[model samples]
Target: MNFKSLKTLAVNGKQVIVRVDFNVPIKDGRVIDPSRIQAALPTINFLCEQKCRIILLTHLGKPKATHDPACSLQPVFEYLAAILPGVKFAPIVPGTAEAITRSQEVRPGDILLFDNLRFHTGESENDLDFAKNLAALGEIYINEAFSVCHRKAASVSTLPTLLPSAAGFQLQKEVEFLQKIMEKPQRPFIGIIGGAKISTKLPVIRALLEKVDYLLLGGALANTILKAQGIAVGKSLIEESMVSEVKDLNLVTNKLRVPIDVVMAPSVEPDALSQTVAVANVPDEQRILDIGPETLELYKMILQTAKTVVWNGPMGYFELPQFEQGTKQLAEIIAGLNAETVAGGGETLEAINQLKLNDKFTFLSTGGGAMLAFLEGKPLPGLEPLTIE
Candidate 1:
């Protein structure tokens, strides 16, 4: 918690390099969701008011150090121009002479949008010389990409040390919310966790066991848990390897809540077939794609009186229309609940949007990996540099 606030520093006429997470979903060369961009605006607007020459740095989809035109941030610049009127933005790819020249063109109140930093391998590698080259572009570094803070990328972890660094408003807010849920959430606190694998969410599940009154499992993660408990989950996605680990948790504590029934199908196609059945009755060749009505009602009942709730991952194979019911129903439940509910992760965000329930929650996070890391008390390489300690 020792990180300096963006407000504590003088930004007047100084060049400020803001590392923002603009890895938004795009389709046909257009940004489909502008929420991530909108999240960074408060920090950007504050910098604008301070009359600082701004340089916006971010990565799109991973290119793994290879330059791919498909992963360009050009659409983002276009989206920004539409939102922030009167702001001049010059787009340039960093690690080039042209980028340096473009940086010179940025005046007070103007921004230089650096293209996908992943185009150069140094970004992912956290190369020192690359960090120095990036630091040369500005006098101050503001780590605004809380979504990517768990990584040790050049701009995220390295540049912060090479320049005067601080957390942006979005990062600060994310940290506060993480603390709110993990450190001081009100009871009866409940957590609804889902997704494709138990391996990824194991630490988070273990962490929640200590704090939440009930830790509900769903999706493939639930299937694995069921398998551990010696339940027959037929043709469902279950991690046979993680079953032993899940089994071991039985000895640790008793917060793990499980589903009683699930929606099943022989094939997960759009219109093949589906049926809601008890967990003990899953057919041999059928897959458990969604939670059954009984399980859905069970969740609603538990969430009805929750004083605080944190949910990550979708409740089922929410991408397929046939299996989206559980996740959507959970979203609706969280939306209507009179509780301090915080929901996040990529699939969970998609579920919230698909159900059009964004504003209904108390907080929506931009970070996925970073959120889990913070909740599990793991070291976040990017945020560590800014920590006052």
Candidate 2:
């Protein structure tokens, strides 16, 4: 909350480097989703209004500190050019003299986008020398990539220290909404957590368990919890290593709600025969694919009285039509609520977008791991240097 805001900075006519999250899904050299890119428009437009030479720095999919053509930002640049005419692409390697030269050539009111930052060796390593070289590209740094705030990558954490830094509109908005959920959510706050693994979400789950009035569990994650409590999960996905850790969380709390019934199937195939069964009656040959109608009804009843709701992940394998009901119905239920609803993570947003209920939520975060880390009360390295010390 103490971070400097982009609007408060004196950035007139300056070459400003804006770290944005344009890491949208790309297939066959075309962007599949432009939501992440769209989320950053407000910040980019504000810099344009100031006549700043806007230089964009971002990473696509992980290139593992090596140059990968598949991870190139060319497709993204093409997509951006169509929306904002005259936006230039600096195809040169980052942290190089050529890159710096391209930066210097950018005129005020022009936007220049660099290739993948991860294409450089020092990017993921958080090398200060790399950051110093990058700093020469601009006079100020504005972080608009809230989704990458949890990382300690060079562009995220180190480069900010080399220049006057501030949080962009999108980052500021993300922080404000998440902070409200963590600090002082309205009473009757309900949190719904689902997904495939407990390993990644345990911290957030533990944190929410202490804060939320009710915490609902579903998906493969619930399977692990159910198995830990001596219930038969059959061949369902369960993290054996995490069962002990889950048991230590003391599942006796009235706030924690696990599924009582689930839809089971032999496999996730489209033609797999499936049926709804009580949690205790899961067949030895079957796996839980989605929450059953009884469980959905139970969750709906609890959500009705919520004053605030935070959801991450989906209730089931919603990619298939048959298994999509639980997640679809959950979205409809939450959207119909009058409460403040906040949802995040890739799968969760995909489900919401599929249901066409995006505008219904109070906020849909672009972050997945970053949102979880923020909600877990963990300090994000990328955010630390941006703080007003």
Candidate 3:
């Protein structure tokens, strides 16, 4: 939980390797979401102010170590070049003779963004020797990629051990804000936890139940929970195996608030005839995709009374136009509230962007898996390596 801050480190005229999360969405070879890149600017700018030769380490997409052009960081590099004039791109990745020569050639204030780290299988395997090669390129290591901090990759995990490591500005802020919610959030705290499945969110959900007053459920997890109560969810996505676990959870927790109604359809198609139906009245062939209008109204009233609201995951299948309404409406409602709000996860970010309500929340966390892990009171692998003994 404790790590050195980047500003506290002495990196004047040093080659600093910064692990940033530039794993943004790309469409037709163009970066669609530059929020991750923008979030990293403060630390990158600060490193430049300290006259550090900023060597940026990041992965774009899931590449199978073949240096696939489709999974390239070239668009990100081009964006950086436009925003940051004179930024350099290494011709080769680490572990090569040319990469070694390139590392020595960088001057202070110069920026060097290497090719995708995932291009080498060693990065994800946490290969210490490969980490050592990466560390050899810099005297200091900075991890600003809290989104990927949950991953035990060589660049984020082992590389920090070989060099002086510090948490980047964005990461420090993420810890501070998320810690605020976990430790001492304001009175009448309301948590809205939803997503595709109950499996991925189980730990955080259990953790939230201990802290939040009213925990509202949405998405397919709500369907699974409903199924446990013997309610007919039609042909909705239900984790049948997790039904018994939900029964046990219900016996323990009274703070959970499930959807009273849901938007149902015969299929997941865009043109599937949708209808708002009571949770108990869903037809045998209908799939539940979104929260109903009544549930939205209930959530709005509950969110309005809260002093602090912590939200994660979309309330519905927001990527689909029909199912986006519930998530969209709730986003606007939260935007209008005076609560000190905090949100995390990729889908949550997507919803926030869909509504352009980013400025309304107190903190829109950059940490994804790291944020969830932190919320669950668990230590992150990428962060553990940065801690002082």
- Clashes by residue pair, model 3: none
lDDT of 3: 0.86
Candidate 2 lDDT (Cα, 0 to 1): 0.91
| TM-score of each model, in listed order | 0.95, 0.96, 0.96
Error of 2 at 43 (Å): 0.8
List residue ranges in candidate 3 displaced over 4 A: 95-97, 251-254
**Each prediction's number of clashing residue pairs:** 2, 0, 0
Q: What does candidate 2's lDDT look like per residue over 132-190, in tens digits?
A: 98999999999999899998888999999899999999898999889988899997999
Mind giving the per-residue lDDT tens digits that candidate 3 earns over 191-305? 9988888887888888888889889989998888888988899999988888887775662454788888899889988788889988889989899999999999989888888
Worst 10 residues of 1 by lDDT: 86-95
Top lDDT prediction, candidate number: 2
Query: lDDT for each of the candidates?
Result: 0.86, 0.91, 0.86
Candidate 2 runs further than 4 Å off: none
User: What is the Å distance of residue 367 in model 2 from its true position?
Assistant: 1.0
lDDT of 1 by residue, 1-389 (tens): 66799988887789999999999999998998888899999999999888898998999998744668788888888999898754555455675667777777778878778888988888888999888888888899999999999898988998999998899998899898878778888989998888888998899888878778988889888898888877788889988899888886663454677778998898778786888999989878988888888988988888897999989888888778888999998999999989998987888897898778999999999988788878778989998998987
Q: What is the C-alpha RMSD of each candidate to the true structure, in Å?
A: 1.9, 1.6, 1.7
Model 2: ten consecutive residues of lowest lDDT: 245-254
